[model samples]
Target: MEVDLGEPQMLAIGQLADRTGLSVSAIRFYEARGLVTALRNRGGQRRFLRSEIRRLSFILIAQQLGFTLGQIREQLAALPQGRAPTQQDWARISRSFRNSLDERIDGLVRLRDRLDGCIGCGCLSLRKCALYNPDDRLGRLGPGPRLLLGDAPSEPAISPAAAIGSS
Candidate 1:
């Protein structure tokens, strides 16, 4: 139930939840995390500004895009506290976040292209591993899927048939 109380542009917590499609507890959690703020009514009930709808919506979208809560908080921090975020403020944050999203997309593309090849785990048990990794020399570079992580394979590439014949 929304408690209007004749307030101008202020929404009760439940009203905010309905508008943002978030549970009241979830809104409270965001508040505690400093992502949102609430004003107390005369009955000491939580009231959020109407502008919070957009803010919470942004939070939802950013979280779905793989942003951490801390990163969302930092982005929200760049906006003015007492007013609704302007288009310019959101654009500035988007410019900063775009670089990070681009890098992640590039990494996913790399992983997809190299997934069929040896990951440079240094085991050298697989036929492809013998050709790409060659006695686990990549282990000296570092651990954990070196080739997938953008590390070049130490040995020259060979056809799968040649590798299988050697095995």
Candidate 2:
């Protein structure tokens, strides 16, 4: 985002790929998706603004953080194309991700914490796990890994000794 008018104002597609470490096809894909734009020179060759490097960098980070391309495109559209984004602009854009980021983190945490517990599906074949679920009780919540779907276990798993005399 540093404005160095000293460098060329526009760069060729190959130069953009080199500077951004993206393949030519990837850069072209981004353009097709409207995440970046290219202009045609007199020879009909594609040229891109130097600022597109920063834009591509943002796209890379957003994808790494599990954002869908559509979501990244929406966020990038908020940035003004006439100039480089100021720090304040970035802050505002970051704020927009806060709720979504928190939700994503929460889901990951839930999966991490609950994945070991029996989901009442008996998939693990652990007959006496403390979190053992019986009779597909977790299925009452719905299909598709109900425990992972946020359904709580019906009870703490019964101890094996306690289960032995009960039939």
Candidate 3:
């Protein structure tokens, strides 16, 4: 059903949950996390604008895209609060994710390209498998999956074995 914002449709909490396919508790959690908000009726029941369906949908889709709740909340928080977000507002907010999404896609592509080789070569035994890790080294590159992240090894991995033989 189309929400007529001009008509100012208000949905009860349960109705919002039913429409969004989220449990009532999950909706409350989102509210607590500052991802969405709800008002209280005269009887103290939770009430949500019908437009909240779209807001909750964005949260679900952003999570599916691998964004954490913090990230999603931050993006959504950029919009005007206490009101339904306009399409332009949503478009601008979603655009912020584009760069990170591209990076994720690139990482996935690299992983897919190397997966067969990593599995088939059986290089883990060598401990020096080119596909596994040519050098167990720590580079100037900060923390994280270094090789998988496409960083060249800046320095050889320092190990007690290397130190014992060197001395």
What lDDT score belongs to each candidate, Candidate 1 first? 0.84, 0.78, 0.73
- How do the residues 87-151 of candidate 2 rate in per-residue lDDT, one tens digit apiece? 88878888997898888887788788866655445464554333455666666667766666556
- Measured by TM-score, the strongest candidate is 1
Q: Roughly what TM-score does model 1 have, to 2 decimal places? A: 0.77
RMSD of 1: 5.6
C-alpha positional error of residue 80 in candidate 2 after TM-score superposition, expressed in Å: 1.3
Positional deviation of 164 in candidate 2, in angstroms? 14
Error of 1 at 160 (Å): 10
- Candidate 3 colliding pairs: 137-157
**In angstroms, how far off is 13's CA in candidate 3?**
1.2
The candidate 2 region of ten consecutive residues with least summed lDDT is 122-131
- What's the lDDT for residue 133 in model 2? 58
- Measured with C-alpha atoms, the lDDT of residue 80 in candidate 1 is 81
Regions of candidate 3 where Cα sits further than 4 Å from its true position: 1-5, 119-128, 131-145, 152-167
Name the lDDT value of residue 161 in candidate 1.
70
Per-candidate TM-scores read: 0.77, 0.71, 0.72
1-167: candidate 3 lDDT, tens digit per residue: 98664855889988999999999999999999887878888999888888789989989987987889988888888887777778899888868878888899888887787554432222344434442344333233555555567765454444656545543
Best by lDDT: 1
lDDT of 1 by residue, 81-110 (tens): 866677898899889888988878878888
